[model samples]
Target chain A: MDYYDIVMDSCSFPSGFEHALGFKRVFVSGRDFEPANTDKGEDAKGRLAIGHSSKNLLHAARRFAVAVVPMNLGLDRAFIETLRENSTILIIPLSVTYGASSDFALSTNMHLASKMLAYANKRKVRVGFATMARSFEHMESYMQLIELAKLIGASEDEARQGISLAGDLFGK
Target chain B: MKTKFRYVLVRSTTSLGTIDEHEFSKGLMHYIGATNYFKANPRVVKNIDGNSFIMKVSLSGYSALIVALALMKHVSGKECGFFTIYASGTLKALGKHIGTPGTETHSKSSNDVDNFANNNNI
Candidate 1:
């Protein structure tokens, strides 16, 4: 069985052991979002229930040997340029929401974001999806985001290969 | 020696109209848990000419700071995103690309800006 790496706010950590078991990796980072297990400081599994930085996430990605991690990819020319230059850290960028109906909004729409990711993949960058899910009920959004990445431009074989790579890196 | 920070120029894409610099700056500080940093240190949000703003942060924390800003989905029910425009070790270097307030001139096209940004970062 394979599990996904889920990034969420600290306060929304799984309600119980069963809920926690559903994910392979969980990263809870947000100042306004507090941790669920306030008393223990760490969860039952010894994972800290606190906020952290992108550097922490990067370290996690490195430790798991995952080629790509889902994160907020900035649209700024310099930031994007820096990203293209690094090439080592692959990221699946989050969609930029610009109000409900702006050209910026349209370009950052989920469909278009996936298309952009597809184009990036063609350039040999190991892109991954980091769709934010507020709660377990948001699984639908997560699935849709992944499906968007998998279905666009990627061949069936390529999709399967990517999955295999993810499993090899993250699976227990 | 005076402390130096990694200067970043950020463009706000989601605000419906012009951004309220004071409120947005406060929100940004809270979002990044820099409230104490703000209280202790001087405010770094300089050259708040329009939608774009320049900020100075600890050099080591630059990427993490950008990530924190990038993770924000909504603020007070308004959907928004922070796009990084330029980052440099010095405000002077960043000002070269973005220009100083009241003397601003954007010389490059959007596509060219992207290319320039991409080529120079690594």
Candidate 2:
């Protein structure tokens, strides 16, 4: 079965329904942030957006699941407690500052990955870490991936192999 | 005789690479003077390699012509003038690397076009 991973955009979910239904493994990105306004009830527009996105993802993937990665620094314990039983939530610790130096970005991403791994182990949640494209340079991105692997206790070679595998599965 | 509008596809790039699909269609509708615009079934596909994807888009209604013309100006950056109207569609995709391809069409109405263009600074 084909596996598909998508970076969730609040605006693009409606147009993505059909393709989501056909993939075997679906990864919903940016699941860490909850609706800004949660008091409108279950049928609220914000909740509905996420609900619809998640519903389509679940329907599409034969082994459907989600990974919640905190976007802003608002990663609260309460929010983590509300996730569905099967969800894998990753908690990032380092600050993400855009327009920063390459070294700074890599270090921040690595630090966050390590912290997230430790938190996952503590909580007994089977979790994995991912970083955004630090920069457009291939070498820079690859280096960041290496740092992430080291933090995760995977060898550099293992990390490279996994990325290649992911590329084969979902890279264009 | 009914006036026909035309659009010339423009290219855009992002951190990942070039943005293959036209991001907004409503902008085109206002440029051509369309009253109401609507999209047909739209399909987009990105390759597993994270390189590129194919998108098929279509538009209909009397206002569609105006939208098409605005699209051409936005993409090609050329002012509208008396020119032969080409009815061929547009196709574009994004990837790690960039490449150029033929054009595609988006359906949108006049109001939708104005809002989209103004919002995007097109």
Considering every candidate listed, which one attains the maximal lDDT? 1
The TM-scores of all predictions, comma-separated, are: 0.35, 0.28
Query: Tens-digit lDDT track for model 1 on A13-86?
Result: 32332122233444443542232232322321222221123333333333332243323332223322333554
Expressed between 0 and 1, the share of native interface contacts present in candidate 2 is 0.00
Error of 1 at A42 (Å): 42
CAPRI classification of candidate 1: incorrect
Instruction: State how far residue A54 of model 1 sits from its true place (Å).
Output: 26
On a 0 to 100 scale, what is the lDDT of residue A117 in model 1?
A: 57
Encode model 2's per-residue lDDT on B3-87: one tens digit a residue. Answer: 3322222222211133223433433444333444434322332221122223233444322332232123222332221111122
Question: What lDDT does candidate 2 reach at residue A5?
Answer: 30
Q: Per-residue lDDT tens digits of candidate 1, residues B43-103? A: 3455444445566677655544554455444555565545455667755566565533322
Tens digit per residue, CA lDDT, model 2, A81-157: 33334443332311232222364664465454555444544556543323322211101122233343444454556
Where model 2 places Cα greater than 4 Å from the true spot, the runs are A1-65, A73-75, A80-84, A89-109, A138-146, A152-172, B1-122
Q: Ten-residue segment with the worst summed lDDT in candidate 2 chain B?
A: B78-87
